[model samples]
Structures are given as C-alpha cells and as structure tokens.
Target: MRVTIFNYGAGNLFSIQAALRKEGAKPSVTKTGSGMKEADALILPGVGSFDQAANSLPMEEIREVIRSGKPTLGICLGLQLFFGGSEEGRAKGLSLLKGRVRRLPPSVKVPQIGWNTLNVERENELVSGLDKEPWVYYVNSYYPETDGKWVVATSDYGVRFPCLVAEKNFYGTQFHPEKSGATGRTILQNFLKAAKK
Candidate 1:
C-alpha cells in the first residue's frame, strides 16, 4: 500500500519512512499535506510542537480527510494534534477527536523517554497482535486528555493516560511504534493489513 506521511517541519520522516518501507509499504512524505487522497493511508509524525506543526500546514483539508476515514496513524505529537487544542500552545489542533493536550504532571519525570509498558484496555486493530503489556518508546512531556471512548490502551507515567487510541479509521499511539521494536512492527503491519481491506 502507498502511505503518505504529513511532515510538520522536521517530522522524523526518515525513521517512519524506514519503518513503513520495512513493512513493504510505498511511503512518501509531504510537508503541505498535499496529495493525501491518492494514497491508501496517511501518517502524522511525532516531530514539532503543537503550535508549530498545526500552524505550518493547511489543517482544514487534512482534518476533513482523516475524519472522512482515510486510515490514519498518529504518533506522539501527532497523536496530540488529533485533539481540539493543547496546552503546549495557542494554536488549535485538528479536533478530529474532542479533547485537549496537557503537560505531564510534575510528579513523574517530564519527557518520559525510553520504553514504557502499554496496558491494553480493549482489543483494536492497532493493538491487535500486541503483547498484553507491550513496552513502547516515548519522548514527550505532554499527553492527550480526552474521553475514554477512543482510548484502546493506556500507560502510566505521572498519571494514567491513553497510549493507544482508535476511533473509526483513525488510530493514534502516544508512543512511537517505529521505535518500539518488534511490537511496533506488528502494529504497523496490522495497520497496513487493515488498510488493504
């Protein structure tokens, strides 16, 4: 399948593109969110901050496309942008899902880098073959705060927050699947498999 990744300025394109290619996907990167409809799937990488990423691109088109169920995968900051807004900045998010991004509480270390366990809350295609407690890599200080309806799995830092979310064709991972080793590959494979059908 052809997967298009919307790069929000320096949006870790290499690693994600590599991941996609390893899964036998024809992946391409676009900075302007151009030619999204032509691809079988879309991706929003975990790169810049909320304000920088959202303001740089034409969000209206991207927002509607994902909402239309184009089979999307969002990572880290990419996941945060799915919400309505963020405490990270004044810029508004895609609001594809109703919620807000908030800074991680001071109790735990900020920028929860390295591997963290994913506690599966329910079964979903994104986490279809994942181990019960998969340790995924994360590098962020902010997280999405939203209704539990979309959340399929969660992880605890300073607080328990959604680690994997799936609503309609939109799937988001607060942790980086590309950086999560074998478990990550399975998740990506599942997404590609689902998009094919």
Candidate 2:
C-alpha cells in the first residue's frame, strides 16, 4: 500500500518511516498536498506543541483528504490536532472530530512518559489483535476530552482519558504505535488493512 506520512515540521518522520517499513509498508514522507492525492492511506505522526504543528499544516489540503474519507491515522500530537482545539495553544485544530484537547490533570505527572495499559472500550479493526488491556508507549501532557461515542479505548494516568478514538474513516491514538512494540505493529498493520478496503 502507498502510505503517505504527513510531515508538517513537527513529526518524527524517520522513526515513523522505519516503523512502517518494519510493518512491511514503504512510506513516502511529504509536507505538500500533492502527496495526499495519490496515497492509499495517510499517517500523521507528531511530536511537539499543538500550535506549532497546526501552524505548519496545510489546512485546506488536509481538510480535502478528510472530506474524501481516506483512511487517516494520527499519533501523539497528530491525534491532538484532530480535535476542535487544544489547551496547549491558541491555534485551532483540524477539527475533523468534535472535541477538545486539555492538559492532563495536575494530580499526575505533567508528561506521562512511559508504558501504560489501554482499556479497550469498544472493538474495532485498529486494535484488532491487541489484548484486552494492551500496553503502549506514551509521552504527552494533554489528552482529548470527548463524548464516549468517539472513544474506542481509554487509559488511566490520573484520570480515565480517551487514548484511542475513531470516527468514520479517521482514527487516532494518543500513544506512539511506532514506539510501542509488537502491539504497535499490529495496529499499523490493521490500519493498512482498513485502507485496502
């Protein structure tokens, strides 16, 4: 499959590409809109503040891809950008999904960087072969706060927050699937499978 990884100046392109390669899919990294037109699937892998990432994105181009209903996956900050807006910055998000990203409660460590278990709230192809409660890697200070309808899985870091979400063809994960191990590869493979359909 031709997977296009969006590079809007804030994503971990190299690692993400490596992960995709490991999953048996070659990836093309680009910041231009032209790449999206020929892609079978889109992966937005990010690692940085929301405002900077939002500023770097080609808004109209991204919206066009979303409107087309192409399978799109967002990781880490990439996922946060799918929301209406984020508390991390004043810049608006792609707003592909109805929700807002908020800073994690002060009760827990600001940036919960480590392995955490996910509580699957619903079943979907994205987590197709994952265990009931699978461990994934995370590094973030903000999480999405949305209705249960959009949440497919959640994790507890001081509070039960949405960790995995899906709405139609769009899917997102708060953790870095590229950084996670076998479970992460499964998730990527599932996303590719979904794209084929």
Candidate 3:
C-alpha cells in the first residue's frame, strides 16, 4: 500500500520510512496536501516540540486524512498532535482524537528519555500480534489524556502514563517503535497489518 509519512519539519522520518520498507510497504515522505491525498495510509512521526510541530504545517488535507477513517498512526509528538491542544505550545492540534496533551507529571524525569516497558491494554489491531509489556524507546515530556477508552498501552517513567492509543481507524504511540529494536519493528509491522485490514 502507499503509506505516506508526513514530513512537516518535526520528525525522525528516515527511520520510519526505512522501517516501512523493511515491512515491504511502499512509503513516501511528503509535506503537501496533494501528496497526502494520494496515500492509502499515513504515518505522522514526531520528535520535536508539539507547538512547533503543529504550527509548521496546518494542512487541512492532513486533518481530512485522519477523518477519512482510513488507517492512520501517530508516533511521539505525532500522538500528541491528535489532541485538541498541547502543553508544549499555543498551537491547536488536528483534534481527531478526544484529548489534550500535557506535560508528563513532574514526578518523573523531564525528558523521560530512554527505554521503558509498554503495558498493553486492549486487544487492538496495532498490537494484535505483539507481546505484552514490550520495551520501547520514548523521548517526550508531554502525554496525551484521551477522554474515551482510547488508551491502548501504558508505560511507567515516574508514574504510569498512556503509551499508546487506538480509536476506530486512529492509532497513536508515545514511544518510537522505529527506534525500539526488534519489538519496535514488530510494532510497525502490526500497524502495517492494521492498515491492510
């Protein structure tokens, strides 16, 4: 499938693209509306601040892609971008998912960088064939709080926080599955499978 990766000046796109290639999926990087419209599925990978990331490209096509009900996945700041707003900046988000991104509780380290075990919640397509409590790489200060039961996974830094979320055709992960080794690639594979479904 033509899986498009959003390249809005805020993500580790190369690694994600490479991972998609490994999964035998045709992936392309784009930052324009038309480029987004041509894709069967999309991946929004984020590694920068929420405000800068969202404000970089306020493309309506990207928003519509999420609303179109086709499979869409967000990683790290990409996950935070699904919220109505973020604590990192004043810029509003696409609001595809019901929630707000806020600073990870101060009880933990500031960046919350490094590997952490993921607590899988429900049996969703994103983690359908993966093991529970898989260790994934994370690097963020803000976390998403969805109003509904969208939470798919949780992780502990200083306190437990939502590590992954899935709602209908929408999916998000706070951890960088592309950087999390074998299990990480497996997570991407799970996403690819979901997209195919």
| Candidate number with greatest lDDT | 1
Sorted on TM-score, best first, the list reads: 1, 2, 3
Model 3 per-residue lDDT at 124 = 72
Q: How much RMSD separates candidate 3 from the native structure? A: 1.6
lDDT of 2 by residue, 65-95 (tens): 8878988999988899888799999998998
Worst 10 residues of 1 by lDDT: 4-13
The Cα error of candidate 1 at residue 142, in Å, is: 0.5
Q: What digit string (tens of lDDT, one per residue) describes model 3 on residues 1-197?
A: 89888777743578888888888999987766446666778888876677777777654667877788878889988888888898788988988877788787877788888998988877777776676558899888888876568888888877677888998887899999999998888878888888887
What TM-score does model 2 achieve against the real structure? 0.95
TM-score per model over all chains: 0.97, 0.95, 0.93
Question: Which candidate has the top score in TM-score?
Answer: 1
Candidate 1 lDDT tens digits, 95-150: 88877899999998888888989898887887777776788999999998877778
Q: lDDT of model 1 at residue 111? A: 83
- By lDDT, the better pick of 2 and 3 is 2
Tell me the RMSD of model 1 versus the true structure: 1.0
Show model 3 residue runs off by greater than 4 Å: none
Candidate no. 1 TM-score: 0.97
What ranges in model 1 sit over 4 Å off?
none
